[model samples]
Target chain A: MTLHNKVRQARTQLGLTQSELGVKVSVTRQTVAFIEKGEFAPSVALALRLAKALNTPINELFWLEETAQ
Target chain B: MKQFFSIKSPLWQILAATLLYVVVLLITYDKQHSTAEGFTPARIGMFVAAALAILYSIIYTMAITRYNKRNPHDKLSITGVKPAEIRDEDEGMRMITARATERVYRYHSFALPLSMVFIALSDASAYGVSTILFILTLGHYLTFWRGVWPAFRETSEE
Candidate 1:
């Protein structure tokens, strides 16, 4: 029922902290933290921005586990 | 004058207001306990304290307005635009606050009926118990969301 993301992995892989990612996406660091923890789902605009910031495709970054089939 | 009034710190402002409310409540209780005396000093003190509390709320509203203008687009503007401000604006905190609000709403739904039952069966002052519970619940949510939750996030980062 929720979207899962590899935000933390991608953020770390790019040598970026949560704050840095949030800054790039015009969001708060805690938002980045929640999104990574699967506690909050990001809007499409935010997802795309996050992908661009991490230099990854949106699909690779976020997915719905329940709808994987 | 403007600078002094607009020196915004939301958590402290809320705490001050809560303290003022408690003072007013205590003064009223004292007046009621000695009601045989017509319009005692405590009765006057209660009105004065209540008036001060109302003034404090007006000041707080003004402070919030000034702060929000100074830091437009910043969600935690009342605390100013510091690096730690990010914690207050975090989506996680917002989500947690939303969940807490929902829980508090449900708590009130059950608590109201239970309180009515207790009041009917006892000599407890309905107004006193209701006021205390309201303040406690409000203080808990405000402190957690505005003070503790954000501080916890900021500390974890360090």
Candidate 2:
């Protein structure tokens, strides 16, 4: 299973750049970029903070994708 | 001076350092082989310091390559990016680095013993081998540690 998130969507919706979102959540722009690209999974605490930053719920922000067998 | 340094990329910094290291190593080797002087603490210290610098440059090169590949367009001066940023921005990168480092450690575990056997059998300097290995192992560990350390930090502050 892979974790997918709507961080980019939400950030754009809020008119926030990756760097801006990262600042809101106390991370670097690269971190935000990675999160958006689904290359990196955030810790629970970070996920919660990210959700709060993007004004979305934890479940709405991130969900598990079922991989092919 | 800030702009002066920024003009040269991390790649350049590494190339320059490595080139200098080679020259120094050659000089040291020539001195040892040609001179009748015995091994001294000062000589060992000079080699150790030089080796450490080269190892640091190598690590810097890896980090710069990764950062440039990730960021693109913009240039980050050699000292600009923090280890936390590298770890934080790329989960895939961290995983890849961790896996590669582990593989090196595993190989070294076997290679080190073999090296010891070779050292004993041949005229290899045990002190030199030990020093090089110590610096190399420490550098690898430091690279990984710097990456993970921020994960344990409190999330309250940036």
Candidate 3:
């Protein structure tokens, strides 16, 4: 199972740069970029913060996917 | 410009200084041993390297202090900060640091015994022991940076 997020899409819709979103969520810009790229899975608290910063529902922002091995 | 003064910058400087000190120590070990005189050119070189290392450490401390002062809300603990700490800027970075630290731990676990074996095999002098320690320190930083630099680069590029 992989955690997938529409953070980039949501962030873009809100016209927020990675740095701006990072500032809002108290993370580094690189962390925001990593999340958008699906390279880093944030903790639940951070996920909630990202959701709040992007003004999206956490369920809508992130989900899990089952990949066939 | 900001990147130049980031927390990582002082770390890099310290690494460079340490590397120089180690190189000088290794290169001068033989000459210093052979000389009866207390102050040879090699000894002077080693002294200079040690001085540079001390200077860089002072600079690192000052930089961290200044950074902490400037960013009170994001102040880093001076005593707790290691070169591998990077920036505890977010969960992702903290995770990255954790991974790097794990690598360092594994590296030392393996390297420490090996180093002891090497130290035992060789007639361990103070110079020899210090040199090995310096090399090990360099390897520690290298292992940490190996895990971190790629992520840092990717983040910077974005």
Candidate 4:
């Protein structure tokens, strides 16, 4: 799945609000919104932070099309 | 968000169409103009317009398009570009950039000597249009190179 579900899923799992996730990821909540909507891609650095904050490995947090293909 | 278009296709189309327009304008100039001076002003204007459009395209691609691409610095994003063994990848970019500069410099440096022939044979309007076209194309490359150097090519250097 894309980042929308991923962000919502992760946020719920951690019981974090958008603002809290933003604080954890060191981005603005609006930036988090864009990422969740797949309008913007987070940098590799930010992705690692998000994965760490959610207590999940990076791969589970993101799925490549190549995997399905 | 609501709409999207392929980036490179439109630019390549524009380049091809502009070249064709220039060729057609050249062929039709004498038939359309009783005096070469009459053709000079508009030809120069078209050249300027084309040049500006090209420059705008490059700048838009570099700066505006960045938000759309996965951040190269982010490690966890799907499309994020990992910084590998290369520390300060821009140094690699500099080396490649130096090589590219050498190539472009050599190619464009011979331009004046070649175009000097046109200076004598060309009508004033023809000369003006030609010079404007050259200036605009050159300016586009100068801006394009600066933007590309810091972004794409720089990130993937040797």
Q: How would you encode candidate 3's per-residue C-alpha lDDT over B61-93 as one tens digit per residue?
A: 787788888878777665773542465656888
- lDDT by residue for model 4 (A1-69), tens: 334338668877778876688778766455565466565566678788888888888888766553343
Tell me the RMSD of model 2 versus the true structure.
10.1
Q: Candidate 4, chain A: TM-score?
A: 0.81
> Which candidate comes out best when scored by DockQ?
3
Scored by Cα lDDT, where does model 3 land? 0.76
What ranges in model 2 sit over 4 Å off?
B1-104, B117-158
Candidates 1 onward: DockQ, in order:
0.34, 0.25, 0.63, 0.03
Q: How accurate locally is residue A58 in candidate 2, as Cα lDDT from 0 to 100?
A: 92
Answer with 1 or 4, whichever has the higher lDDT.
1
Candidate topping TM-score: 3
Residue A50 C-alpha lDDT in model 1? 91
Q: Give candidates' CA RMSD values in order.
A: 6.9, 10.1, 3.7, 14.1
Q: TM-score for model 2? A: 0.50
Error of 1 at B71 (Å): 2.9
TM-scores vs. true structure, each candidate: 0.64, 0.50, 0.78, 0.30
Give lDDT: candidate 2, residue B51. Answer: 77
Error (Å) of candidate 1 at residue B70 is 6.3
Model 4: residues with Cα > 4 Å off, grouped in runs: A1-69, B1-63, B66-68, B72-89, B122-158
- The candidate, 3 or 4, that scores higher on TM-score is 3
Candidate 1 pairs with clashing backbones: none
| B1-158 per-residue lDDT for model 4 (tens digits) | 11112231123334544554565455456446636665476576566666766775575446324534644442222233631211122232334345545655665666555555555576446536555455545544454344333323221111
**What digit string (tens of lDDT, one per residue) describes model 1 on residues A1-69?**
568889999999999887888889988676777788886888788888899999999999998766645
Q: Which residue runs does candidate 3 get wrong by more than 4 Å? A: B1-5, B9-43, B77-86, B124-126, B155-158
